[model samples]
Target: MLGELAEKGVRVTVEAEELLKSREADLELIVKLIGLQKPLISKEDVESLLKPPELRPVEVVPAAAFAPLAKEFSSDIRLNHTLDVTGKSRTRGEVENFISYFRNRYERLSRMLRRNGTVQTDLADVRKRLNERVRVVVLISDKKETKKGNLLFEVEDMTGSFKVVVSQSRYNEKILDKARGVILDDVVAITGKVLEPYIIAEEIEWPDLPVVREKSRSENDVATAYLSDIHFGSRYFLEKKLQSFVEWLHGRGEARELAGKVKYLVIAGDVVDGIGVYPNQEKELLVKDIHQQYAMFDDFIASLPDYIEVIAAPGNHDAVRRGEPQPALGKDLVSSDITLVGNPSSLSLEGVKHLVYHGTSIDSMISSIPGTAYAHPEKVMVEYLKRRHLSPIYGGNLIIPENIDYMVIDEPPDVFHCGHVHKNGYVQYRNTLVINSGTFQDRTDFQVKQGHVPTPALVPVYEMKHGRLRTLDFNY
Candidate 1:
């Protein structure tokens, strides 16, 4: 009945009518009304009425229907016209009234900006510099109360350190109570004035960063292989092939170079088969449970030598934020050998600064640059170094903090490693050796569906001696 009325250019109301009883009665009435209102009723309008709503409707008419009407109405009318109050031009008068209201509001803002010099303030260099404030999320380590009731907080980031002083006297008593409860490693955002070099925090906000368990360190020449995004819970996870790779690392025929030399192992992220990941994803999952998926990963990491240092950084598929440059898992979950670090982390490997970032964005960048993406992911990584960002854009697959500097290379790194696209590549960037370690898992359902044939590869070992580096690829 509603569809029939909609087709005949009749306004649909909530109350049911007695004239439209069944489909046959509505169809007859609709045909009659269409003939009478031929100027208003269109075939396309009837088709739209018959088709089901794209999204489920509620008690009220869906908002989607009004969007097109609103757009059309807005386009035809200007928002600064004078109103014509006469009833002879009622339709035009109503549109003019709305336009007048919009124009009045805009003019009010314009007048305020002119009177207060807000527009000029934006252009003034001194005012711009004075208003230059950066909001930072810091993990408050230590806090002390000053004589004047100001709270001094010390915070640390990957790059360097800074201090935040909050004037406790200005805040309400309840706010002070909440501020006192701040704990160690509690991620908090501080907004304040930058006094030349230091930040004088005006306000503080809280965010959650899970407490991680710590692992013991080992003294050995043991090299740990760090790789991310295996997608093991998916049908793409090659258990047999991964098993062969691990066994080869342990000491298989003709592959003994990796046995004792590989003292550490890390699976950075995407260890599970996620639900609702993409279209037809449910059909591609081999293991569905996330906990069971981690258990499998634990078993795989455990199979490595006990002396090996195993660490993991959560990926988009992992039970953490699907952001770039994620932090390694804290000490809580896995064994001591397996340490979890942030997604993009820096470590001193044999006295060489090695920065690791899972190269997920390299695909888009590679595709954009001519003859870059397919030929070498490592070369693309070097491009990121030039930009000085681990992940540049805000919300593309990887989440990054507002004030955190992922690109600041204060001290040049000797080696850089990343893995996400499952393609193995290497390149020399300035003095840094950039490596994109290929995956150990064989191609799965996603690879087949997406038509991505990955190069199944073993680890590439890098040895630094006498200020020179030697890279060796060990195939299993």
Candidate 2:
């Protein structure tokens, strides 16, 4: 009945039907909704009579005209790997795959660390040498403090695992500090002396950022605006401020001059106030139905100027799997008009490669790294780039692993855009512009309790010509 209704311009989904059923609405109420003055009588007019005013029926459009910029610069925007594969491994195979993947990561960094003059020894070899000085690279499997207050680490290699001890008395302040900051699963080079069953560490080394940076600046005058976390249908959604931005894009106010130059808009994710996304979410939602929520989002996007091509990716709140390498929302939710891609996707806007990630793993990044915090998201972005992987630690965030590590930064992007922290941050790392686009939603009760001040309605526009960034404030 819903599919038949949709065919005649009435849009309905499982979510919408459930909401409607909850009301136990009569035909008269349904007729009034579709703006029909005539009474509901004939079966032929049933679909048109029940169609809601707000739900704009989906219209198919030619994809070529506004196809994602990724198509144009396919060579530059490389999807190194993805987890969208069938026949995923069984329990034992999954464990083996995880171990093998990390082992490869360990070996790769180990070879890189070898240039630092650390004699590379396997975990098995380290066990052989008792009461002798040794240097080795290993993946930290586990770490704990003893009753004696010394940090003990169970590090492993392909050969085997060994216990590494950082004695409070023996190791100096510098070594202890590094040991304290050591993250589990992080492959590190350790220089130490072998004890009875443990290696007493002298120094710990991380695969830090490269000194020489490679930057890209476009010769073209085109610019792109980065945005995310719109959370449409939430009471906190900044409708007025966002409309002001759209007005600016349509050549209004001080931003009128920038309107012509801005050719692309990248939305990182959390595009809607998803149904049942959190506890007490219904109280916060202005639109309770998921289809209605997306309908509003679709209308909002449709209102934007056609000159600026919009590229969107899904986040945790989107109607997709809650895992890394999440696919785009279904066509039923999002029309073909938007260039929708998977989360953590890469594209190029006029020669400038952009890495668009929802940054759901930002929590993990902040917690795992000692100095990093939510307020300074770019610091975490820098850490991700330095490590050349997004969300390195597995258990921190929900992830569905594939044969290849899709999170690995095999190909570096010129512009990296992410959002989820709701705090805007921008920085340059090795020539790449790392930007946390922030949110369009106002501060909620949760944010207030957390003491997080979101930088809403501040759109970061990147001037591709000179690699310069200018922020446009629409709060006024």
Candidate 3:
């Protein structure tokens, strides 16, 4: 392997040489390593180059970020493994896999719709019973508007396909609103009857939760702090503001009382400014090495109050696979003191079920759904609940065709949490609290060009007892 590197005009340290020589070299991995455009390869470089690399801390994340916790609290974080895709990835990406994957999604969501007592007939059965109002569970394949201000779409089930249309002149805002939000590849129940060529829609129903829901609360007064998009290794990372945040966590600043009640901290993703995440991202990185980036993240997380049980998931920027349902960050990224789960992981904190996602697909939702924007990600998060499926548009985000569809929001969570757009937003929809806990990094050139104003270093704390949420502005 060292000889191969030599041919590529690359020099390797003695440790790197021993590490490479010790193992049966993987040619593809070596090729990727050389592709990094590094002049010298050290043991650290070799180690970091491996997928899900072995790592150790190299830089501190604002060494003065935190003071020691004045008081200790009991931790009560329980991960719901049933919905987590951590250890259960089993897809080979074969042609059959995609078929079975979407089939499973249709069936699961179909059953959820059935629970609403809306399954009146199958698509084939609907064709048999012409001119009859029969509800059929169908996955929308394509949609477009007509010249007469009507929404025309095609939907399909295992049995057959049907052309459906909803008239704008009908003035039914409820049905029109639902129809407007329907993107491609969404599973829904359409109550319409066949008229030889078209199915005139009467109502459209989603596999959403009950209109009335009971929000659960923790037994104790403990709270959980939500945050993400720390971008620790980026030049825009707000170090002094984060220092204030850590001080607040130690009951040293304003909202000291609230800080004392924070027994858990949930960070959805983007804990660090990952190397090579975007074009020319290197120029903005304070720490160029990926290992050092995570090292800084580790130090910052390690500096937090030990009693505050921390849970982290992966994001687009993190060193995880490039797709939704990203598996948990490995122990190499952070200390074992924290719990790591997959992106869009479900877990219980103090008896309150919280759905935590890195929310990379917010971009897709914003583009597909009208009135959804980066500044108001909570509105997009609500769409996820309404559809009861995260990343409903198959091609909108990169998805692994795993046998099981982990993106399905099988159960409406007490709290739906995500972070990706670097915007702070919180809203309670139908008893489900939705939160997009902004970023800790200041504005960047990309955001400036995109006209996005980020609410950096603003922390959201969810009070468990009353399902109340409040933000602490540490951006100063």
Candidate 4:
């Protein structure tokens, strides 16, 4: 090996050679080391090639515009794997835990409805009274449209489940329309007269999001750029456009002024398009190997401004388990400076709580909810807020049923950030800024067939000081 390296004009230090021998360097590894074109190979060079690089803390700009703002603000950001319950439950435990979790959600929502003069009656407690009227709140477990046009719902509570009927005659067009929009696994308040073996529902009520009249904002000026679904390594990856955005972050053009004020860059999910993600995926891949795909992604991150803290989470297409609450990318895939958090993570930036989810479950909600469409993603996000859960509908999305029920949004965040539908959406729901970060990957063949024209290279910058959300387009 020494003679071979000498032939290649590369000199290996005595220490490097001793270290390699101690580590029992294989022939292939020795050949690879010799390939490193250097007149002299030092201990550090050999060590770097052999071991993973040391992780460094995210660089903080001393003269950052938000430095003073951060002093007054304290972040209780949930660190990586802080409250993860994935891979920590048995089949029976998962079933029992979720049942209990949903039941708790039901009780909490029912109490809120009760405060509004709507009394909740358990399915088992309701009895058919002849010539008497009955109105109660119930959780709808199942619903079916009858051939004669009446709506039949199988609702349940902790006690039991029962059948509720909504006749087209008693209810007006508006009420009937509402009944038709009723999705299963929703907690609702039904009102009307009670008949034999059936409680005719005159009105159906959803556990709606409460109106928040006042919203809070930071006293000092600070902002964060929201991005997701870059899908690097795919043929559709918008490399030039994304490069432009990165340049803008490092101070370029009119965006330079805004760039200086950006304290953080939050990437929600789908950082890279993995291998074998879907059928015929290889046909659209520019980088065939998953490691190479991540290498390209890491290079992109390396070009980003070190002063800006970059936080990333995984999505369905990421090289993680095909389930919600996905773990962070492997050490080889992502750089150390970037904070790799779990899917459906809760982030605290200067004490401002922001819930970041990849929005995989949004697909299920779009199909299940009537008024919802992919064109208006923020509308569906409202359902998660109303339920105070990230992915509430079980069996809709591929979620690992953990014991702690991490899907439940225990507390309202100042910002609810999600991305996955490849569209941009923003709205203020009950003082929470709900935003769906757009994608970097342009329209692919699959997306074209699905009628989705992704709004690529658009980043939503949330200004905490002003409590304002704005989108910056870099497609040009």
Candidate 5:
């Protein structure tokens, strides 16, 4: 019915959408609404326009299911080894290991930049050409702005370090704009004129993904539903709406037809709001016991439809290590039949590759990168793809500095799914579908202070074969 209204040039709020699905509302009113010609219909609009012939008792629907009714679900889903960090974590946090970690990251990302047909020279030998144009790949060690508003970056390769400056007056407007988004520790190729000590940058090239990669389509017509930032134990958790979503998966009203085609469900992260995550966090939590919170999560997963294969990862709020390449949720945390992987895990479903990250680094990217905010995380995600690495800024998040930089996006997944900001955003960049599934938890006091508006209970369903997307709001 929401889609029907959308076709007729009307958008409905989730609350208004819920009323339309209730016994109090009817489809005939949709025709009346179209006649009214209001582009957006809020809940109050429905209440004012909708008048029953007489007052009667309303049928109160159950808020949640007592148990998950699993059905026979058989789908082609396999976990890929390259991205999962489960038992392969190797790091001592020593200075020597940290050196190895950054060097390894540089090698991988610099190789990607070299593939762009630019002959990269080491910083030690870049000056041999003298005043000529030269290309060099280096990690940004420090950055500052000159009094004249020129951008100066102290960058270095393994061999040596040098200063590269992008003058606001001398360089093109595009180069200055791109330089504004550059953060520390970013491995990128800078092409410029070697002027004595400084390299006057003219062009900066990141290890971005190719624009023409084939977007793999599934042979089957199954769709995948994504849920994230559930925060099950939080006081702000939208239990009723989540319950409505679950019931919808089991053939509830309105968008029931699309529900049947959903073969896989991915929960990006924040399965439970962990203890002591922040100051005064305990006061906002309903279930203070952490294990009991997981118990509730286990019960919820156990209740899911059998045909919908569920794969989940941890978030900063989960009972896992707060690091970029976090391991999977411990077996002791869950007992339900589901695939448990690391924070950022890769998998293949219906022949399409999916990179599932809890998206903890989104905050860092948003703060460091210009033109990024909590509202449009898909844009920030594109920066990750452009840089060919997640968490490019080292101190942005708690990274363990493992020998291997698991944060590097070595292989581009066909679909990238993430959720941490609690705001839903979807965009397809360079044939890769990027989706931030949003959150199931409602706005909190912290979010209010941060000016973050969460699109709670708004879920996205993706069609595997056709790349079609449909969103269902369960904030009813």
Candidate 6:
């Protein structure tokens, strides 16, 4: 190799030869030394020596220059380091090997930060001084009770490991006692305050709990009906029938009997005929543009009586990620009378707590579980309550948000309402009433093709009196 380098006009300095003989000359060290000795050895020459001759560097225009030579060199260094670590026997290796692995990973990550120009040395110093407060969510791996009454918890995160000590105070005792025997991998959020090199936990919280409402439920005589997934922009959208039902609400009839009673209205999801939603769907869309579709929906929602409180949530069709229990519509789209909330919002209605999730995935779940799809679609709400997830299965038809965690309601609701399959159904699970309000949209060509006929029915009314209830159907 030395004689070949000399023949190629590449000088092998005495120190470089000594380093190579000592087996301490890594690719990066060699490149750096070569560059220092001979500034004329372009990056291409170094790359050619590293690999097979067929893989030659392509010449590019000066304007379309390749990335910096230093960057390419650093990347190659990191790649070689990774390969070296991965090829070694992890079990037989000493602690030094583990340290080397970690160091390499950290250095590679640092290189990535430097490349992006996002590395802040000042911020790192500040982080060290600030005690390195890290917010980590992990499942409690194991817990040990010490003589001092402090509970030592071993926690693990995606990156690495940590520990939490809960002192034997009344508050901590209660928390630790509850945490014992928790399923391995049950996620919990822990806030760690750095105690020099180690982190001391300041607090631990359950991420699944719903936002607690501080105020007590107010006493009110007015009633509210919540429904969603109307899909108003579809050809099957029943504008005339919906108008008739609206007329019945304002006119003197069964719906009018509870006219002044209904104080609020909520539409949960799928408010529009989604763009390119299904095959041959272009012809069925009454409103093409998403913003315009929402505009039309605004007009329809506005047509309702002003006295009724309206709450609208974003559905799969709306201009948001196709996730379960999405947030309410933007303020620009709807009137002040409306309060938009997440798809699955807990509302205290006349002292009756109702948990509403626009039933998007209920059909699939129901279809999977025997007797659920045919006999009762509403019972699937009970399944969700049992699983403690709005949409437990990921990659379902609905979209879930990446960052914002879904709030879990520990306290069961008095009623649960959902609508997506466009089937009006009802069932009772323990003390909770599960209601799936049928869609306002009538049968579509898709339904006909699938040999499924949707039941066109009016909204069902419920009367709650001191935990007792009565169901009334307004089919007319």
Candidate number achieving the greatest lDDT relative to the actual structure: 5
lDDT (tens digit, per residue) of candidate 1 on 1-476: 65656655665323323223444545654665555555544445555555666986557753221111111211111111121111112222254544453233223322322332222211112223454676554445567778988767776543345776666664446556555544443345566676644567655654211123221222333344545566667776767767766665655534354344554454545656556666787787777776666777778877764545555556566665454445455343444454456666666544555666667667656654444654467777766665444543334344433222333333345667777777777776666667777775677765778777676655565533333223334343
lDDT, ranked from best to worst = 5, 3, 4, 2, 6, 1
Clashes of each: 25, 0, 0, 0, 4, 3
Lowest lDDT 10-residue stretch of candidate 3: 63-72
Q: Per-residue CA lDDT of candidate 4, range 1-476, in tens?
A: 55555565667888877776555435665676777777789888788777866788899866433222322333324452544443343435366767775766677666655666655566666773543566566677888989988889888877777788887774367788888777767777787666757887777766555675455565556678899999988999999999998877766645555666677788988988989988989999999988888888888878976666788888899998887767777687775567787887887776577888999999988898788999989998988887666765677877665545667665677888999999999998888899999899989988889998789999999887778777889988
What is candidate 4's CA lDDT for residue 420?
Answer: 94
TM-score of 2: 0.76
Q: Residue-wise lDDT of candidate 6 within 42-86, one digit each (tens)?
A: 445544555554856788655432222112111100011211111
For candidate 2, write residues 12-57 as lDDT tens digits. 4455555454454365655444554333224434444456667677
The list of candidate 5 runs beyond 4 A from truth reads 1-73
| TM-score head-to-head 3 vs 4, winner | 3
Model 2 misplaced stretches (Cα beyond 4 Å) = 1-119, 129-134, 147-149, 169-171
Top-TM-score structure, candidate number: 5
Q: Relative to the true structure, how large is the alpha-carbon lDDT of every model?
A: 0.53, 0.76, 0.85, 0.76, 0.86, 0.55
Better of 4 and 5 by lDDT: 5
Task: State residue 53's C-alpha deviation in candidate 1, in Å.
Answer: 83
C-alpha displacement of 77 in model 4, angstroms?
4.1
Ranking by TM-score: 5, 3, 4, 2, 6, 1
Point out the higher-scoring one by TM-score: 1 or 5.
Answer: 5
Between candidates 5 and 6, the lDDT winner: 5
TM-score, cand. 1? 0.50
Off by over 4 Å in 4: 1-118, 128-137
